[model samples]
Target: MEYKTILVEKRDGIATITLNRPEKLNAVNVDMRLEFLNALDELEIDDNVRVVIVTGAGRAFCAGADISTFESDPARIRRNLVNLKREPRRILSFEKPIIGAVNGVAAGEGSQWLLQFDLMVASEKATIAWPATSLGMACPYGMIRLASEVGRFRAKEALMTSKFLTAEEAYQWGLVSKVVPHEKLMDAAIELADQIKRMPPISIRTIKEAVNRGLEGYEYTYQAAVNQQLSDDFKEGVQA
Candidate 1:
């Protein structure tokens, strides 16, 4: 399917989804969110697609949600938050492996989405952080995912203080699986996807399902918070 904010290309059992709004740092808007969901749905059922990679068009992967949307209509604040809460989980729960190719800075909600990927390849020039607290909003999912990726204390510092970590540091902290030179980010991601394509698809799907089942209770809680964030406080924070 054609998309306005994203470009989807599939080849050799690999599907690459590029966030196309580079001028705005590929920030998530309503259209982008819906298109992304649709693209994922398509990829999930495609028999030829064995792995999926998500990246951005230019320097940044995604800076965050588009603040301009909230500026125009306060109600969009809740809408954006709800989208963030749901989409990442959907990507995480997908049966096929999903890889994150972090080409540059991935901040705010973008950083949160990175945690959902099964594997990650980040450029050496990339940086990741969550600046939600600085914007006067709580990032419950970010906090939980960050802690799970790194450690509790470090995640707290990163989220509360909005500290950005270099790609090397992220890899060292176990946040990203691999760190390569900026130009090699996509190549590394594609290489990994190729390796996954060579593996038995049924085994990969079963392992993913079992792992997800192990976290069934936690997933439900996360989804609930994602839905509950569609509240006045979240809207106010987005408007701010």
Candidate 2:
């Protein structure tokens, strides 16, 4: 499928999805979210792609949702929420291992995406945060399984404080697998993907499935969908 918000490239059993809207710090607009899910759908059935790498095109990994074009109209909100549900569902359910090449800032949904990735390789310049509370909204995606990654208290601090965690701090908190020099971020991610590719394919798929299944979050994700729809604060936050 042709895409405007993301770029897809395949090489040696590895597929990379680059969030392409650099002008907006690769922030996800409605179209971008659709493109992301479409790309994943296309890649899921492609036998040649064993592992996937996700990154952003410019300075930031992704700045989260694009509030400038966010919708608050009731009808549009319903449609948008459907996509919101699909975004995390697709990532969590994808059978192949995904590596996050976090080159810069990853906030809000960006941070949420990183949390779901099988492995996250952050650059020295990268920063991760969940600014939901500050914006008068909740980060259902972040809250779903963040505690499993970083301790429960850390997850609370992250979600409630709306502060940025530097790459090293994120690493120390167990948010990312490793931190590398900015220039070597993709290399580190690709190298890990290659390693996964070398492993038996079925083993890789089964292991990923087992690990993801062990985490419980879909219930919270569903509830968040309902809560966001009825939330005046969420509407105000997104419009701000």
Candidate 3:
């Protein structure tokens, strides 16, 4: 499927999806979300695609939900939650490994996206943050995922404080699998995907299934996020 807001390239059993709104820091607006999901769906169904790499076209992996789109229209935001059909669990559902090449700062939903990747390679210049609280919004999945990654205390500090984590710090916290110089980000991610592609496909898929099964409730958590879009805090936060 053709997309206006994202780019999908497939070659040698590897598919790369570039969030293509660099001028907007690749923020997730309604159209971008739709195109992103379409690209993901296509990649998932392609037998030629063994591994997927997600990165941004320009500076950010994703700046998060573009509040500017629906800040004033709570009804529009609510409609988007239902119509966008962007089930976060879909990322976990893909049998192939999805590697994140965090080329730059990942803030808000962008940072949240990093948590969904099966593996991550970040640039030395990359950073991650959750500004949800400051924006009067809340992301419980982020809290859970962050806590699962870096422990409860550290997650609290990061989420509550909206602190941006540098590449080294994120690696130390176990959120990033590897960190390379800014220019090496894609190389590292593709290298990792190459390694996975070399292994037995069944073994790889089964192992991924096992790991994801161990972490159940993704559906529940994602639904909560949809519900959150209707909250007064979410509306106020976005408007603010």
The top-ranked prediction according to TM-score is 2
TM-score winner between 1 and 2, please give it: 2
Q: List, residue by residue over 1-240, the lDDT tens digit for candidate 1.
A: 779999999999999999999999999888998998889999999999999999999889999877776543446544555666677578767889999999988987688778777888999989998887665565647766677768889988898898889999999999888999888888999999999999999999888766544333445545554544455665566666
> What TM-scores do the predictions have?
0.87, 0.94, 0.90
Each model's lDDT comes to 0.81, 0.86, 0.80
Residue range with the least summed lDDT across 10 consecutive positions in model 2:
214-223
**Model 1 Cα shift for residue 174 (angstroms):** 0.3
Model 1 pairs in collision: none
lDDT of 2 at 28: 87
- What tens-digit string does per-residue lDDT give for candidate 3 at 1-240? 778989998888889999999999999887887777677788878888899999998878888878777644567655675643344567667778999899988987778777867898999989899888886555646766777778989999998899989999999999889899898888888889999998888998898877765345545655676667767877777666
- What does the lDDT read for residue 40 in candidate 1? 90
Q: How does residue 44 of candidate 2 score in lDDT?
A: 90
Ranking by TM-score: 2, 3, 1
What's the residue-level lDDT of 88 in candidate 1? 59
Greater-TM-score candidate between 2 and 3:
2
RMSD of 1: 3.1
